[model samples]
Structures are given as structure tokens and as C-alpha cells.
Target: MRVAIVHDELMRKGGAEQVVLTMLKAFPNADLFTLAYNPEGTYPEYKNYKINTSKLQFLSRSVKWMQRLYFPLGVWAMKSLKVHGYDVVLISNTHSAKYVDIDNDALVFIYTYTPFRLAWEPTSYSQYVESRGVYRWVFDKVINYLREIDRKEAQKGDFYLGMTKETAQRIRDAYQVEDVTIIAPDVKTVNFKLSDKEKEYYLVVSRLEYYKKTDLAIEAFNELGLPLIVVGSGTKADELKRLAKPNIQFRSGLTSEELADLYANCKALIFPQYEDYGITPLEAIASGRPVIAYERGGVLETMIPYRGDASKATAVFFKEQTIESLKGAIELFQSLNFDPEFIKAHAEKFDEYVFIDKIKQFVTDKYRKSRQKSSPKPKLASEKRINS
Candidate 1:
């Protein structure tokens, strides 16, 4: 059957993009549909695919207006996507892709990283609009308007694949749709390896953003006077670097091998972000490094605790997104003894092969059921007698 795939954006390479890459492997012939596409901005591997973009993509090729008005415009552009001939339209996104239009018989299977991250989290949305201008209220209205559209679009899906149990509940809360299946994203076990010798520094692999609470990590490390490496680039990169102490190092444009080396040698990962399904902490744990993270979102689903009532936890949690809490968690992490082999073993559950297998089975099962329902047939008495 002809299949189509939609993703939130191809603007950059991140966890979501990696998930799309996996999807492409699962459905090799599927055409990629998106509101925008930038071969340079996204993963170079995506250039191998036949990516069909909306008109908005061509219009914003030079100016990149999508970065500013992505929600409203992206939602509008995606609604124009025609997914009629395909038997299944598998969509992946933190928010936008679900709005893509589908024909009556086309089955929509959504692999949501989160149910519109900015809409569900007030602080994040506020940070987004606050960064824009004095007309925060006007922006708020616009977001709310987009949210209503997003909510309706969500129900159009035949099924929802939540990255975690917490995210499944969050999906229900966001869209009031209970037909969700749990499917975890995976890590490249071969890419990350434990180091023979570890350094006396912390690490954070997050896109620099206010909502990520990266500022807290920087502030805490500044006081600790320990080497902390922040590996990522974003709009907040300059501001975060400016606030960081001399001990804090910023590394961007590092290759996967280089990143794995950094991961192998770091004391532990300091994860301050509240993500839907964070892949970085798992990657660190896979590299045999413990993680000290805020206790919220997808981390709660993936990370294990070393303290009371814990069961093979690969990481520890800070109660709040504050310097004091993180500093205390760091102190707590130092006092514990985490087995590197144990951490790596726990991380194996999220290997890329496992995730791909699950996706194949899920989509295949869904496709079979949809086809069966559409062509409703009963077993003949002769067939039943022969079976009996």
C-alpha cells in the first residue's frame, strides 16, 4: 500500500527528527510531507528522501518567517496536505503535523512526542510570547486560537502513540482521546560507550531555551565552580553562555563520535528540562553515566532512582527547577554509587532496533484491523467446519 508520513518540521535535527528517520527506515518508500523543509537546517540524511513541502516553505525560503509564526501558519499550511491515496498516513510531531488533512478512508496514526508542548505548558507558552513583544496578550490569543485547531485536529487521528505512560495521560488531557498506544523512542547503543577514565565535570545536552531551565544548571555550576559542558545551540545560546561561569564550556557542531566521547568522560548528565520523552539522558545512561534531572515529564518514565523505593534507576531527580535544588541533587549524586554497566544495561531497553520493531508491528496491526473493518466479511460455514 502507498504510505505517507508527516512530521512537525524539518527545520532542525532533534529527537523528533530522529524518530522520523526511524520511520523512514520502517516505511522506505513513504513520501515525507511537511509544511516547511530546509535541506541544510535539517539532517543531511533527509536529503535522500523525496520531501514534498507546502507553499509556505517556498515563500519563507529566504526570510524564514516560519520561525516566528510557525503555529498559525504551519497549522494552516498542513491542513492543505492531501493524504488521500495512501492507506495510512503516519504522523510524528510535538504538535503541528496532526492538522494535515486526510481522505475519508485514510488511516491516521500519530506518533506524538507531546500533545503540543507549548499549549499544555503555560510557562513555556508565556516564555515564547514574552520573547516576542509588548503585545503578549495578542500573542496569547493567537496561541489559544491555534490550540483549539490543534485539539480538533488531534481527534482526527485513528490512533495516538505516546512516547511514555505519562505522555499518554497528557495526551488524554490535551485532546480527550483515549486511543493511545505506548511506544518508546530508542538510543544508538553502539554510538555511546563507557570511558576508562571519567573527568570531574557535569554535562547537559539540551537545546538552549528558557523553558529547559538550562539557566538553573549554569547558575548551579557557577556556584559549584566545577567544569560543566553545555552542548547545543539555540536562540538562548548567547545569553546562557554570557551568564555561565568560566568553568562552563559551550560546545556546538560536535559530531556524534565527539559527543559520545564527551558523554563517556563526564561525571554525570545534568538534565534540567521538562521534556515529553527526553533522549539525551537515556543516551548518557547508555554511555554509563548517571543523570541528575528534574523529576517531571518523560524523565520520570525513563529514568530510575538510586534512593529509597527505587528500582534500577539510571538517574536521580531534583524536586524543583532551581539552583539550590539542582546543586543539592548534584551533591546527592556524588554520594551515591551507580554501576556503569548496570546503567548501560537498563538503557538497552531503548535501543533503536527495539523501537523500530515496535513501530513495524503497531502500524501493521493497525493497518490490518482498518482493512478488515472496511471490508467486513464473515467466515463461511465450510471454512469454519474445516478449521474446527
Candidate 2:
């Protein structure tokens, strides 16, 4: 069977891109398609694959600026894919890969990271547009147009998968699709090691973006005067650095080995974002470290919150996004003792191997059923006798 894997874009490294990488491992022989590709911008493992890109690749050369055109051009790019001959077309989508044109017989499964955030979650991204008057006006117009296109494209998929219940709900709200299945993304737990000796510094492993709320960690850590290691780079990198105190140190461009070392030795991870389904917190837990996270979004589903027992708790939850709330959580975390082996065990449940097994089984079952439906049935013995 010919299998095709389509991703929205391969311009940067994040949870969405990680899902695509995991899919490639699951379907090693499948042909890979994308709207664009940037070797230096994304994970290096992609360079090993034979990647097919859409016409938008010319404009997607610039990893930073090209994303502004992704929603519109990404839709056009997906529509341009030659997925007709494939038996199964699996899309790792967040922005616009769901629009891929394919034959009616081809099974299309969309593993949605979320509905296009800019089109559906305007309030979360208001900071990006609110400052520029003319830009904001144009953005609102484009978003309105994209919403209709997104909803229409959503109907083309044979099945939909979401990373968490929160994202599943968002998919239903944005696309009016009822049967969204939850398939949580996973971490390569084997890459991380459980450590009993931890350094004094707290950790924050997130893209430094406005919506990610990395600034909350900076402010909270500044007041606490604790050593903090911020492990990511983004558009807000400079501004976040400016906001941070001397105790906060920033690092980026880390290899998997280097990152795992950081995760293992940190006192705990400070996660402030209301994420779709966070990988960093799981990565931290896999390293036998606890997490202090916001009490909303996917973290609620992943992190075992600290009530009175630390033995079963993997994290301490802050109710609000404010710095004070996170600071309070940190203080509360200091009083609790989490079991490293227990935390590590909890993270192992969402290992990459689990995702691979579930996805492969789902595809096999679906493909088998699809073939059963389409294949012509043999005549019964009585019918053959009658014809003779």
C-alpha cells in the first residue's frame, strides 16, 4: 500500500513538528509531503527523508518571516499535493494541511494539533496584531476569510485526531466536527535519564512567545532570586531577556543529549503556558523532575496535580497566569517531595513507542475496513448453483 504523510510546514521545531517526526518513524516507507522545508530551521532527522514540497517552498525559504503567509499560502500548498495514488494520507496539521486534494477512495486522516490558531483563537494572538494599526486591520480581514476555508477543508478528512481533550473541544467548536478522537503526543522517554542529584536552578523549556507566557516565569523567578535556566529561542527572546533578572540564564540550540541533561538535573520545571498538550513538562517528568504549571489546558490532563500527597503528584498547579500565582505554586512545590521513580513511570505511559503502536493499529484497522467495504464480494454457493 502506498502511504503519504503530509505536514503543514517544516519551518521550525516544536511539538507539531515532533509529531510529524514520530509519524515518520511509525510509517518509515511512507512518502513525506509538506508546504515548505527549511533544513536549518527544523529537526535534522528530516534531512534523511526524501521530502516533497508544494509551490510555496520558494517563499518559505525564510523560516522567520515565511510563517506570516502560512495560513493562506499553506491552504493553497496543501491543495496542490499529488496524493491521489496513495492508499492512506495522514496529515499532521495545525495550520492548513487538511485541504490536501485526494481521490475519493483514499483514506485521509488528520491528526490536528489544533484548529488554525490565528483564525480560530484571535484573542490569544491579539498581542501580535494589536500594536500595528494597518496590519491589524488587514489581519482581521484575512482571518475572517481563512475561517470559512478552514471549516470547509475540515470536512474532507475521513477521521480526526487531537492531542488532548482541550484541543478536541476546540476542533469541534471551530469545525463543527463531533467525532474527534484524542491521541496524545509523546516524548522519547529513553533520551532522558532519572537523576537523584538535582541542581538548585529551576527550568523553563518553552518557546519564548507572547501566548506561551514565558514572561511569567521570568518575573516569578526574578522575585524568587532563584537560579533559572530558560531553554528556548523565539521572537520574544530579546524582550524576555530584557525582562529577566541576572539569576535567569538563557540557552538554545541544544542537542537531545544536552537537553536531557538539563531536564535531569533541574530542581523542577516551571511551565506557564496554557498549551494544547505540552511535551516539555512530560520531558521533565521523564527525567524524574517535578513541574510547576498553570492549571489550565492540556497540563490538567497530563500532570498529576499535588493535593496532599506528593507520592502520586507529578506537578503543582497555579490557578491563574499571573506571576504571583506561579510564584505561589513554586513556594508550595518547595514544601512537597515528589518520587522520581513514580514521576518517571507516569511519563513512560506517554512514550513515543505508545504513540507509534496506537497510530499503526488505527491505520491498519481503518485500511482493512476500507478495503472490506470497497472490495467486490464473492457469490454464495446457492447463487453459483442457480446461475449454473
Candidate 3:
């Protein structure tokens, strides 16, 4: 059967993009569809795919602005796509793929990271505060309209797959849709290895963003006088660097191999945000380094409880995202003992092979059920002779 996999954009290789790649590998014959593809010196693995980008390629540089102005354009664009030939369509979305149009007979599966959180009351407050002027006013109205459309389109899909339980709960709350399945993001294990090197300092690996709470990690490290190494870059990089103390070092644009090295030797990984489903924490655990994460959101599901026993605990939890909470967790980490073997074993649960197998099973089962329902019944011999 022909399959088409759609994604928001192939601009960056984040957790969402990794999910798309895994899907493609599982369905090697499937064609990939996206709004834009900015090579941007990404992983060479992407170079081998059959990619079909939208007509918006000319406006690729300003796609972000365009999304704000023409919020429903993605849905409209999909109406023109020749997906009639495909039997199944899988959408790996963090944004607008829920708006895509597909044949009624086709099986459409959506992998939702979150259900348009920016349209909700308390969440939209944060979005509005981060915007300015007429653009802000215009976007607020546009997002509300899109939220309604998103809910309608969600109902058309045969299945909804969430990357985390937090996201699945949001889907239920926002769209009032049930029967959602949770499939956590997977980590690449080929390049990463368990090292015997002595741990030196703590590490934080994430895009520098306001919502990520990188500042909280900086503040905690500063107050505790601990050496902290930060990897990854984003809009808040310069601002975060300005506030960082001498002991906190900010390095951006490192390859996955380089990050694995840092994860292998770091004393512990510091995750300050309440993420949807963070991959960095899992990577650190795979490298045999324990995680010190805020005790909320997906972290609660991923991290093992730290009870001052090195042989038993794989991670420690901080109940708050504030500097004091992180500082307290760091102090506790210093006093506790952690086993590297136990940490690595916990990470193996989300390894690439397991993730790939799950996707294959989900898609195959969905397609089989769809075919059975659409199959025609056998005609009686007398009815068949009438045509003759």
C-alpha cells in the first residue's frame, strides 16, 4: 500500500523531527510531505529521503510570519495534494498538519505533540505577553479560528497518537476526543555509549528558550557555585548568556555525537522545565548519567525516584522550577549515591528499536482494520448472471 507522511517543517532536527525520521524508516516506501525543507546542515540521514515540499518554498525564509498571517493556508494547501493514490497518511505534527485534507477512504493517523496549547486561556496569556502591537492582535484572533478548525479536523482522523501522556490529556481537553494512544519519543543509541570516565560537572541540553526555563538552571548553578555546561541555541541565547555567571558556559550548535560525550561524563543532567516529553533526559540516562529534573509534566513519567540509594535510583526530582528548588535538588544529589548501570537500563526502554517496532505495529493494525471495513461483500451467483 502507498503511504504519505506529512510533517510541519524539516528546518531543525528536534525530537519531533526525529519521530518523523523513525516513521519514514519504518515505511521506507512512503513519500514525505512538508511545508518547507531548509537543509541548514542537518543530519545526513535526511538527504536520502523522498521529500515533497509545498509551493511555499519561495517564502521559506518568512514561513514563520506567514503561518501567523495565513493560519489556515496549510489545510487549504493539502486539499490540492494528490494523496488519492495513497492508502494511508501519517501526520507528524506539532503545529498545523491537523488541518490537512485526505480522502475519506484513506486512513489518517495524527501524531500530536500538543493540542494547540497557545489557544487555551492561561497558555494564550503567555503567548500574548511575548507578542507586540497589531501583529499580536491579529494572531490572537487567527489562533482562535484555527483552534476550532483543528478540533473539526481531529475528528476526521482514524487515530490520534500523542508523544506523551501530557499531550494526550491536552488533546482530550481541547478537542474532546478520546481513544488517544501515548508513544514516547525515542533516542538514537548508536553513537552514545556508557563511559567509565569520572564525572566532573552538571549539564543542561536544550534550546535556550523562555518556556524551557534555562534561566532557572543558570540561577541554581550560580547560587550553588557549581560548574554547569549548557548545550544548544535558540532565540533567548544572548539574553541567557548575559545573565549567566562565570561558572556557567553556553555552547550552541553541537552535533549529537558531541552531546553524547558531554552526557557520558557530566555529573548529572539538569532539566529545569516541565516539558511535553524531553529526549535529552533520556539521552543522559542512556549515557549512564543520572538526571536531576523538575518533578512535573513528562519528567514525572520518565525519571526514576532518587531515594539516596545509588543501586536503586536512576534520577532525582525537584518539585519546583525555581532557583531554590533546583539548588536544593543539587545539594541532595551531592549527598546521594547513584548507580550508572541502573540509569542506563532505564533509558533502554525508549531506545530506537522499540520505538520503530511500535510504529510498525500501530500502522499495520490501523491499515488492516480500514481495509476490512472497506472491502466489498461477495455477490450471489444469480445476481452475477444478470450482468452476463
lDDT of each structure? 0.81, 0.85, 0.77
lDDT of each residue in 140-208, candidate 3, tens digit only: 787777676666666656688997777898888887878799888788766678888888889999877
> For model 2, how does the per-residue alpha-carbon lDDT over 127-218 read when each residue is reduced to its tens digit?
65565788778778888998977887777677889988889989999878788988899888988998767468999998888798988899
Pick by TM-score: 2 or 3, better one: 2
Error of 1 at 310 (Å): 10
User: Per-residue alpha-carbon lDDT of model 1 for 131-244, expressed as tens digits?
Assistant: 555566766786698677777777667788989998888888888887789999988787899888847788999888767788889999999998999998877899998999
TM-score of each: 0.91, 0.93, 0.90
Model 1 TM: 0.91
RMSD of each: 6.4, 6.3, 5.9
- Please tell me which predicted candidate would have the highest lDDT against the true structure: 2
Model 3 lDDT vs. the true structure? 0.77
Residue pairs that clash (backbone atoms under 3 angstroms), model 1: 304-313, 305-313
> Considering lDDT, where higher is better, how would the candidates rank from best to worst?
2, 1, 3
Clashing pairs in 2: none
Question: TM-score of model 3 relative to the true fold?
Answer: 0.90
Of 1 and 3, the candidate ranking higher by lDDT: 1
